[model samples]
Target: MNATEKFYLPVDGIFDMFTSLTSPSAVTHPVVQSAVAPQQHPKAPSFSKTGMGIIRMVKESWRQPMAHRSSSSSTGRQLSIERQAKRSVDLLELGLAKPKNCHRIVVLGAARVGKTNILQRFLGNDFDESYAPTAEDFHRKLFHIGGDAYQVDLLDAASERNFPAKRRLSILTGDTFLLVFSLDDRESLHHVRDMLDEIAAAKAKLLKLKHPAKVPAVICGNKADLTSPGAVTRSEVTQALGKDVTYFETSAKDGTGLEGAFRALAALGGLPDETSPSRHQLISLLSYQTLCISQRGRGGLRARGHGAPCAAMDPLARRPSFTSDLRLLLKSGSNKNNKPEMCHVQ
Candidate 1:
């Protein structure tokens, strides 16, 4: 037989079985044939009961893929709904209040100078023992004080310091600065001195002052916990950094002198008193909202539960992208007396 005949042989057999099952003389006749059957040739193979099993198997195979497709569509829809729900929950917890003012604080230092650890301390996080070089780290803290929302964005400028243009941009955009150096490394102190010079130049160019006044900044000598006899002395650091800048000796490991330094930073930036870490209570977003509502019913920010103000934080906060940072710089420059000239940075 040809290929075509061979292919049609099983189909012909199936039809024969179906015809016989629906024949008028067949024993079972409770059902009626809905359509007329094709003419059956005498040479066709006789109907076999086994052919019904083949027909049922073919039908089942055809149905499986459609069933599977339906199931996959349902699973995809469910996952989409779940993702949307999670985003809603995050928005609810992170707060929807617009900030009255934001202070952009930048931390500049050489790599492994414990800059990250100091920032962690400010954010109420424990010291991390592991050391990893940072590209750029950003953190945000929200303060609800005096019936106003204030935001502080802290940027850790680690490896970015090597790129002069990016570093200059940070200095220009930064409202407050923290320059950190390790006592164990004298070269790091020199790096800090160079950064200070750059900061002065950048500020002078932007503010157009006859002489660059002392910018709102704090110089931190980190790693005081180390007992290295060869470390730089506090007096030498003071002389190198000059007596004008506010300086502090901090121990990231021991968690000493960090809070005082932060308070000093806030004060220099002209921030609210409650912006100091010790001056406010850190509360969850839900409780913060509850207190704010109750305070509104009683009086304004100073009433009852709102006396200390409430601070809320976002653990998943990240640094703005490069483009966003540039936009922020330009926006801030526009608000000042002079707009900084934009230049190409390679």
Candidate 2:
């Protein structure tokens, strides 16, 4: 059959199927009873009785036209089918599964202050060789710090001088903020006040809403590896940030002080303690077994041979770079081109 004929054939079948589904007796019975009733004209009432009687008459008169115009069985069935189809599509799109508990953390700092690099070291566990500036918002793998899973959203702008107003608003929407400052650069440290002000403004706006106590803030001092003696004093940062704010000295290059900073932020977010026996801890323990086998064989047996020395059987022996192993676990796919991008002030 032609395309038009083919389309009409199913439509005709559907119409016949609907006709079969409906009982013809229902329609004919009503019409036959109406025809059999004698045609009589009623006279109008001359006077109203009580107020209730008049109101009752008016209500019945209004309901008659509405009842006549309302849908029969066939129309109701079609409408129900359409509604069910729409609901099915909605449920499928939403997966009908409860959303996982996710914490949103935002990393904020002046341009080239190692904000993205800190995020990468925490999220990807790999440091980038060359620095490529962040144009817009960037996201990395979700990390399980303490016992809760957090999705970190890193917002590293191109320049401190040109921080977008809207971007600041977006970052403020996060559950927690990680304000980073470069220890090597004095200018980046000076701009910390402006960054904190922007964060406070966002928090103030959020407090005006129904729930006020959800937001938290953290102050992180990056490039701790560069902190020797006279370079950038820890006392200077402590004096600048004050005692109320949480402070951390982190080095993305040497992986110094990174873990403590993340743990502090996670603690401030009210994430469950790592010691808690949770599903995340179970999964992490299982994943670690894979590493144990690759590094130290069964029962501390060295991969080299069974007769090898015990100290030589250390996992660090086989795996020279523990960070690379971590990167493999955290990264979704082994994309060689995937290198961590550094954010550092000139």
Q: Give the Å error, residue 107, model 2.
A: 1.1
Model 1, range 184-246, lDDT digits (tens) per residue?
Answer: 999999989888887887887666568865778898999999999999997888788888889
**How well is each residue in 197-234 modelled by candidate 2, as lDDT tens digits?**
66666555434444333337777777777745545566
Q: Least lDDT summed over 10 consecutive residues: which range in candidate 2? A: 308-317
Q: Please name the candidate that would achieve the greatest TM-score relative to the true structure.
A: 1
TM-score: model 1 vs. ground truth = 0.65
